[model samples]
Target: MTAPSRGGPAEAAPAPASAKPGSRMFASLAVRNYRYFFFGQFISNSGTWMQFVAQDWLVFHLTGSTFAVGVTTALQFLPVLLLGLFGGVVADRYPKRRILLTTQGAMGLFAAALAVLTLTDVVVVAHVYVFAFLLGLMNVFANPAIQTFVPEMVGPERVANAVSLGAVNFQSARLLGPAAAGPLIVVIGSGWAFALNALSYVAVIASLLAVRASELRPATPQRREKGQIRAGLRHVREHPELIRPIVLVGFVCTFGFNFPTLLSGFAYNVFDGGAKEFGFLTTAVGLGALAGALMSARRRSSRTVVLVGTAAAFGALEAVTALAPSVWLFGALMVLVGLLSVTFSTTANSLVQLHTDPAMRGRVMGLYMLVYTGGTPIGGPVVGWAVQHYGARAGILACGLVAVAAAAIVGLIALRAPRAGAVAGG
Candidate 1:
């Protein structure tokens, strides 16, 4: 929607409108659309992370305990687990750009409302929980639309680069958002952080509105049908390439990437540190992930070996990270852990998007997201219990082993299925 050229916020509005929108300008506008999305999403993702940190801070301030904070998080994610499939159905059945406009606008409004509530001294923990749920409810519909919209901006040929760039945006925000939030919270309170976050949404909204309809190669919207959701599920089940990466990612994420449990456990027990130390380790991971995302952008396509091999490497390295003799060593290896983790994620995401029928991409991607994020609810407590009983290193080691095993199992199945198909055909 605009050009600040990554230098200042004031220039973020008003794009060059001299060129008439037509087929001759096709290539330029397509590239421009992708840029708009990338820049808009970059700002939006940062605000999201800021909102997350501020929300947790507010909850703790209100209740004076972490229990309600944990509950707030649960409320936020519960909708995703319950209604995410329905979100995919909506994505397939509607124009993604239109759905995005409504959802993104809704989210920004929610943030602004929350800011007003908190700043006015009328806020409570329950209000935080409610807002959290509302934001998540919006995400249920927004996420699938967002994911499937990627190829439309750049065409199918550049989907991998687009997805990798998206990952880079996320990791950069992951590093920066919380850093910004802490200072905002200390200086002006959580309300200001929330307000700033609300303002950030303008970038995305403006970009979405500014898009030329002729530029995007959007997937043909799936028509409403009785069994669309079930049909999407069946579609995924039938595709080994899609299902294998999805399942591999699910295992790696659940067991290998239980950050809340594993990171906290190691931070306190192994390093004898606190929140600052925890943040240091997290930053290291984010840096590595950012680098990995950059490296992934150069690749033209996703492959079976890269997807499976990265998963296996990610798992083994995670195990090795647990054995580090010092914090320096641990943090260094954790950087590699982050790199491999994002590489596998980007690969898995691209592979799924590139292979799936555009008609069913939304549902398949939705299932993929459910499997990836859904692991935390199951794995976090399990890893926490393991750390409590067996110790942090042992818990992390087990997670790593689980990742390697999942990768190996999926790799075997993928290799065998092709031969199995040949025999069945004969």
Candidate 2:
């Protein structure tokens, strides 16, 4: 893709024969390929979040067991543990657009299936578990491919802008999805939410079809050598710079910010409210996350200081939220916690994408996703059990403690890594 140097819509477009792609926010939107994706993804992400809220509600209502909630959470992410590494390999070998189309369609089907089951009053815990697993399996391929495809939409120089724009889209969706879902669930029921999610897939598919491949940047060359996956693993282990952030993100996501599972407990035990209150808790977080994304978009930093800072802030926020002693205060603190959580996550994602090379970007991102997904798989169960036995406040406090501890350790490690390098060279 051609990089536009001067200001204009052309700057966001793929390198043209006559123009340079400018480095600015919304730069990728100048290009038709990315513009389609940006809007499509925005719509899709909103619908996905709606489904997430509905599905969790469905499972909780069906079982009334925290363990079941955790299991559902685990099922959605467990595939990342089992197949994320290989999924990266697949992304490298296949055409990303094709992969995305297939996966998005599959995910839509899964959501539709859930809607059918629930609407018919035949939905069972096992069915939810099965659908969660199926969705996770599809994500193993979809997530990595989508991340790797960003550079193709706009070149490396404008990557930060592209990343920021994408973050904005996602954050906006997150904010809108739950807010809409809460009312929709009460009025029409969770089945409608699922149906809306299914319909959302069409937007993404249409966007994918409308984009021209010639406008896309070249794909990374596939590595077909034996033990290639092992080589990828070795590379991550050997490079602390790459692996360090991934580990930190995992820790924060798992221990600090897996709130969907705990939110129900907080609603019932802590706040003594219903589904509306629970949904509002999520909406509060979404609002905070949107603010964080917009703030990050303004900065021009290579290091994700925002991410680390947010991790620490999230831990602190969680702790404060846990001590609110009232529903209103707790909801208010959750907004701050949500903002910190998104700030940390989006910054981390941008950092990872910025530093990675195209050849191994898919695999490297997959590793990042693995740590993220892997963290949830383990953390969900632990957090769920904690809430079930301990009071909701205690469970949240434990999660906060884990976040603070992880942030401190990772912060020290990040600081030390560079000093260690300097010392060795000296």
Candidate 3:
């Protein structure tokens, strides 16, 4: 079948060939609803990152176990592995804005509950586990909805730009949140960080409310039917272009994106660093990711070469990072890793959304989020165990090796396959 039109429901006339580069780079923000969503995500994602740092640190403090940290990460994503497809189905059948409002509220409540527990000094490892699981459950629903919602805001012509800008918002928060968390945890304690995160949700909720409902280029809701989930599965199964990149993402995300487990180990164990160093490590990655996002924003299309090439580069950087002799050197490598990571992710994301039918976008993205994040449950524990026994370097090395191997394999398959041009076309 031919690819879906890149123009969306509210798609505007294309810019002229002589249009300025800056206009192309910031094309998506021309839509009013996207601008509100952008600023709101900027604030909320930063708070989310702050809580991430605080939560990991608190778990380590409470248990003094890296395995516990992995478990926390696992609990947070396990629900996505289990229920994400259903969440996509829900996204397909419902208004994404309404789904986001409900899911965002639930997540805020979970953050608030964690904050209360920590503030009262009654928080324990088990409490963190439970709350992490609850948060994961909320994400299972929210992630796919949010992913599909972006196209509705900007229309398909600018979806790639919008996705890259979303990454800019996220990485901006990633840079700020952990940087702030280190000092905040030192001075005020982790509980207040959680409280701040809970309050940050207000920004997103308000933005969702502020968006003009009539302005949204909403997708046609899928009719209720038996075997809907299977239909989604079959759609992906039959489409090599969609499934191939997603398969590559699954491998990379499972093995390559375990930075929480790896960086935590590096900070506490290898570098003999404290909360500040850990925060810096994360911030370095965020900085690199921001650069990558900006670069991706300039691109008009996603291509298979960009996706596979960046994945390979990311893996090579991870391997080099494992062997860095100093904290500064390791942090520097992390920036490169972050840059490659965002490049690969944004390219893959745009490839999937741009190629799929809008009616099926939610389910495809649901699968995308599932493959992207849901593998955490399996990889997190294994990486944590490697760090605990084999050392942080070994754990990082393992991740790099797997990612490189996956990229090589995917690249080889893509090159050797018949109709490679058709499959690799973005």
Best by lDDT: 3
Where model 1 places Cα greater than 4 Å from the true spot, the runs are: 1-30, 419-426
Error of 2 at 102 (Å): 1.2
Candidate 1: tens digits of C-alpha lDDT, residues 1-426: 321121111111112345332321222224888788778988999999999999999999999997687788778777888888899899888999999999999999999999999999899888898998998899888888889988777666556667888888899999889999999899999999899899999999998888778887777787888998899899887777677888888889988988767887888899999998788888888888998987776554567788889999999999988779877889899899999999999888877776677788788878888777756667777887899999999999999999999989988887887631110000
Which one wins by TM-score: 1 or 2? 1
Name model 2 segments beyond 4 Å from true. 1-25, 60-69, 116-125, 183-189, 419-426
User: How do all models score by TM-score?
Assistant: 0.90, 0.85, 0.90
Cα deviation at 399, candidate 2, in Å, is 2.4
Candidate 3 matches the true fold with a TM-score of: 0.90
lDDT of each: 0.81, 0.77, 0.86
lDDT by residue (1-426, candidate 3, tens digit) is: 222453321222345678677887787888899998888888889899999989999999999997788778878888999999999999999999999999989888889999999999999999999999998999988999999999788776778888888888888887889879989999999999999999999999999999998888788899999998898898888777787789999989988998878998899899999878886897788789999998888777777777888999898889889889989999999988999999999998887887677888888899999999888888877887898999999999989988899989888887876743221211
